[model samples]
Target: MNDSEDGRVQQLCSHDEEHLITSGTRYSIKGFRFEPPYVLKRAAGHLCRGHVPVVLQLFFLTLSAVLLLAVLIKGQAGMADGETPFLVTVSSIANTQGQEQAKKEKVYKEMSQLKPQINHLCRPCRWDWTLFQGNCYYFSKFQQNWHDSVTACREVGAQLVVIKSDEEQSFLQQMSKEKGYAWMGLSDLKHENMWHWLDGSHLLFSFMKYWNKGEPNNAGEEDCAEFRDDGWNDAPCAVEKYWICKKSAMSCTKN
Candidate 1:
């Protein structure tokens, strides 16, 4: 070959080697060159594009989960701050109503207790005198002999307690128990072994059961009857003791 032609051929071969190295081309044993096909590159690009939707879907799903959790927390907080107070208010109202009902019941009970005293008579009882049934009773603070006790009651336009029925006897007995021992109007001074009331009525045989056991044997000339908690007792007329006086409660006339 000529020198100029050989130099041109070497330059062309050098340029081709440089291109193969830069483009990552391979050579086979038979001196044939291989290069990646354009289709394989296009397939890689398509694979990368297909993964984009999956990444976006994962991000959006995570965001939705966080938002849902935040909404649930906010709803729970609202219930605690708002609904709790509403429940407490309802409980307080129920408690207030219960207390008011209790107070009303107590007031009604007190009024019922006062009704009997108000409806007994038109006129009120005197000071220090308690009215029960249709009669007024006076419990004496001072002690005196049986006869003197009777006189004291008579001076006040009353009489020593004359128990006519079991009810009256029970009332006098209860009062006498509270006021200490007291004198009644029964006596056998006129006739031994025979009892009579201050109102000139003879004591009924049934009333004798009111006497204490083994009493009224005229022991040491005991002639007067005294009231006690358990029953009646016979004592000397001169014995000093508290007394009870009785009188009819005055009724006012309506014009």
Candidate 2:
């Protein structure tokens, strides 16, 4: 509105709940002079005379809305720019780092589950076919004729317990637990005294080889092999002692 009209409204608005007389008619500002009936009349007059306070308020509100919208858009752009580095690091952890971390956790969980059983079976020598810690190991305590032992292990889901390395040999030596002789995968019955292991280690030092001297003594009848607590020996293949048998853990039917 022009300064005069704005001045009139401003004055009328003061000392709320007081009376105002403009056109020889009395009016009181209970809450505002801009109540509906009066507001409608004044609005119509202002439209005719181009003096509307509500219209001014509408313009100010529109300006404030535009400013608020601009501020919101700028703030969103700023946040997106700063978020790039954080997104990169989160990908590094989730895609690459998270995979490695998951694998490590799985290994640790398996090891924790297996530790006690492995310690029981493999601390000395690990048997490849039996469940020890979280895996499997094998140990046989019965004695059989050489051929019979081989067949027995196979029949129940095992083969000759193959020794892998010097480390393994030493371990088995320790686990032989009995001070007696234990048969291994070595034989020369076809060549009589000229022996070789299945894995092709020549019958080297029968020194610790537990031989009963007059043993394997080329006795054309000795097709069998035996050993003693003292050393290795030869006997008939028909004899049976506490021979070792092994199989997969699942195959262990012994109750």
* TM agreement with the true structure for every prediction: 0.52, 0.34
> For model 2, how does the per-residue alpha-carbon lDDT over 1-255 read when each residue is reduced to its tens digit?
578866655553332212212232332232211222354334333433435554664464355446545655665666656556689789777899778999999999999999987656522234334343222334556566678777776776665555444554454455454534555555676676676655566665634345566666646555544445444456655556434433334332322
lDDT of 2 at 29: 36
User: For model 2, how big is the CA root-mean-square deviation?
Assistant: 17.9
Q: Which residue runs does candidate 2 get wrong by more than 4 Å?
A: 1-143, 162-174, 177-181, 199-201, 205-215, 218-220, 245-255
Compared with the true structure, what per-residue lDDT tens digits does model 1 show for residues 1-255? 577855664564345334433355543323323453444334333333333444443354355446545655665666656456679899999999999999999999999999987776475468899998899999998899998999999999999988889998888888888889999999999999889999999999989899888887788999999986699999999989999999999877654
Model 1 has how many clashing residue pairs? 0
lDDT of each: 0.77, 0.51
